[model samples]
Target: MDNDTLLMVVAQLGGGSWVWRRSGGPGSSFVRHQALGSGHLRRPHAVASARLGGHLYLGVADSSKGGTSTVFRWGSGGFYPHQTLRAWQRDTHLEFLELGGRPALVLCSAARRPLVYRWSGGGFAPHTDIPHVPDVYAAKHFRLRGSVFLCLTRFLGDAKVMRWEGSMFREVQQVPARGSMVFQPLLLAGHRYVLLGNDFAPSRVFRLGAGGRLEPAQELPAPTPRAFVPLAVGHRHFLVATSFKGATQIYAHVTEDIGT
Candidate 1:
């Protein structure tokens, strides 16, 4: 979605997928695009978009039909199926990012280790797998000091922040976050912070403390929080939180002085 073109792509669990495009300006309604109908996809759980080689690509993860994911190319009319990725099954999330200056996609799975695929000039190919990570719900990637890191979120036990070590990613820090769905890392007001959204416990915010370890910052009373997004307007900053059971919350980021 953008200022000029607005599109909404939906992934359905039982019903198929569809794409809706806005035809007019503000207050206009969205209509289903004729190119992508409901029967085009089956049981898609996640969708992500990326641009590579001056072309826009969309990835949809599904499991009902046995094929793991499908990549679609965007044309002047609408999106069309371009390729299919059949390596992993039952994917929980699909994220697209740049890895080592190349376009890449990370597929998180609940039944197998999370896998990363890199664009190979023509299509995406399997590049590496995150070892020892099973039952992952989502993976968020960020760059720090010219290095790449991934926050692997899980529903049980501990979540880990892994750093790319030239060859593969290794665990740099582990955080105890049972029932967590997203460990989102965000940079706000020139400080690094990570938000842990939990279903069983209160959601926590951690700051990058001394020695690069994440330290507890604050806690929110949001129940079953799913994701956190940073929003800024003019000079004021705010954090928007989405929850599964509770209402969506917006928190203002304020600064206080503790002068000696």
Candidate 2:
């Protein structure tokens, strides 16, 4: 595949295996098939599917159960697993970002005192401990524009958004910082807006403000967030490859009233 062409990862199913479909040419649609996800005792806790240097990089869990220092990256007909830490952990999550003008894969371990890992020098290395965060016991990284952010849900503490500022993460500017970070947030609306949650009442909306700030923009009228990521490109195209009740679905649309 050409470096300029994008091989959009369609679905991540069956542990390490991924379902990918190439998009291009005229009148072409998403072609589906399976790859990897074989020969494993432990299920993947975190997964990162990205194209770095003309080849796809698939990050997987080195162990199925917690309490093991293991992270695996796949490419070129093989798998490379590394133990960045000594102790065991759980819910190893991965988010790929461009850090310092290079491909950086951030890993967050789910432990009593969780840790963060970065992929560099062709292996996994410790980046730094997230400040002001006692523990990111369960957190996921969100990339808006080029910066990386984490929405951390803490135990017995308030959940906050941590922004990566080339050095470390700081608290995101939230209007109601003390309120509940309830909804399951997903990047949507051409990556400009984020669909926060599907609460019992109504859906809350948030738009990324200038200087990497998150401001309460609008409400979704309904309470359900149907998509996870933007399926198609362009400002007019609205799409989401989402999972609802353990089932996979594709949602797309073209909008006319993009900006007001």
- Compose the digit string of candidate 1's lDDT tens values, residues 1-260: 24388888877775556788888998999998754534446667778888789887888877553555788988767788787776447777888988788888888877778888888998989989999878888988888777888899989869998887766778889999889998999988777899999898889999976545689989987778888989899999889999888899999898889898
What are the RMSDs of all candidates, in order? 2.4, 5.8
Model-by-model lDDT, in order? 0.81, 0.51
Name the top TM-score candidate: 1
Minimal lDDT window, size 10, model 2: 174-183
Cα TM-score per model:
0.91, 0.62
Model 2: lDDT of residue 208: 66
lDDT of 2 by residue, 141-256 (tens): 66667777766654335566777788667788433322222323455554565444442334455766776566776654342333345554654555343433334434454345
What TM-score would you give candidate 1 relative to the actual structure? 0.91
Give candidate 2's TM-score: 0.62
Model 1 misplacement above 4 A: 1-3, 34-40, 63-67, 209-212
